[model samples]
Target: MSLRANLVLATCTACVLVLGAVPGTAGVAQAHAVLPKPVAYPARGQLAHQQAMDDGACYGWARQQTGVDPSRIASAPVPVIVPGGERVVGAARGAAAGAVVGAIGGDAGDGAATGAAVGAVAGGIAHRQHRRQAAALSAQMQSSNDWALSSYWQAWTACMTGRGYSVQ
Candidate 1:
């Protein structure tokens, strides 16, 4: 083999070896994206608040109906629980990691400040995504509750109508 060809082969082999080393590091980073530890039950007040709001809505609906007073309604609001702790932790962790990455990519003197700004933006984006997810889940839960409430109200109205009362 020619000297030039041997040198080319050696360079190509080195490049391949360097590239191959990158995947292991990438895999470790990917693992860090996993959700953090589960939040304890004590931090679940939001679930109770959601249930109270649902109950209030149903109570208000019953009160507005002419045939059935709020006191007579047997319907109870269902509770909804949305898990958000994981998303919050994930965003924070992602931001920290992003800051480190950005610092490495920035100019030496301004690296930390640039990294912090970039990290904050990235964190906000992640937080927004989490909020969207939480909103979607809440919507789904509310939709299900509405369906159930509609059916219950319809049945109650029918019963009132059968008893010689005009249901508006």
Candidate 2:
């Protein structure tokens, strides 16, 4: 597969792995497959069996229209909080680099101190930026998930209603 395909596949796999399935549910997809349960009545006096058939047809259409498989929504990945060590690592690296420079000029200790401080500040800034990005990504994903679900249910409801069911 191409790089983009590989990345997409990997990300989806990660989502399933990290989030797992919702609890107290049976089977694989069932664990997370929570479709909107709008109370629907057969207004056109359709038979119970016919209602079931319409329900199945509408469900398929809804999935096709929205591309939001309820089965996969629950597996949406939450970003893992990686343990922070950027500042310390940055400080150490900066000190080492600074020490070399300082030794060429005069005092290694003073150079190391200046380097460490500068490195720590830079690292701290980088860390903050990372956190912000993670937060933004998480919010965006949630918004997307919400939209997908709403859109799917709306489509599904519309389908059922069109098929002579009084869908709520």
Candidate 3:
């Protein structure tokens, strides 16, 4: 197939796989519904048992419109490594330094072997250190992203539910 076709197919396949893998749970189900178009919400005082009633109405409406269980929709957590450029740069720097150190130790004849061994060990250590640092940074970034996304999604979902719209 053409490159474009292959890319499209790959993307579609990935999306399908992701959707299929999502856990089936009440919160997830409620998050995936088609948000009502031109969302309408009752006037402030018109809502009785406001939160619960609104959630139920939205869930039922979404079910009727989509023929899918509202309880099965789920919100996926956003991944944290989206901004890993800096970590990549740091890894590249470490690799260059390791290579230089290796070359410096190499000498003519036996010197070359000695230098090579030293360089290999140095490079390996540098690479490991770089990876460990990057991993730690990535973890921190992921945690922050998770917190922010979770908070935003929660608010968004609550609003949609209040508007009698199923959200996922």
Candidate 1 per-residue lDDT, tens place, 1-168, comes to 345434543443353344332222211111112112121221233465554454455445544653444232224332333322332333345445544664576533233333333434454455456556656665665565455445556655454443333445
In model 3, where is the ten-residue run with the lowest total lDDT? 23-32
RMSD of 1: 19.0
RMSD (Å) per prediction = 19.0, 14.7, 17.2
Candidate 2, pairs of clashing residues: none
Candidate 3 per-residue lDDT, tens place, 44-119, comes to 5445466556655655665554454522323442222222122223333444554455457552323333333343
Q: Tell me how candidate 2 scores on lDDT.
A: 0.66
Whichever of 1 and 2 has more lDDT, that candidate is: 2
Give each model a TM-score. Answer: 0.39, 0.63, 0.36
Separately for all candidates shown, the number of backbone clashes (residues 3 or more apart, or on different chains) is 0, 0, 12
Report how far off residue 156 is in candidate 3 (Å). 1.0
Model 3 CA deviation exceeding 4 Å by range: 1-108, 165-168
Candidate 3 residue 110 C-alpha distance from true site, Å: 1.4
Roughly what TM-score does model 3 have, to 2 decimal places? Answer: 0.36
- Comparing 2 and 3 on lDDT, the stronger one: 2
By lDDT, is 1 or 3 better? 3
Question: Which prediction has the highest lDDT against the true structure?
Answer: 2
lDDT of 2 at 142: 65
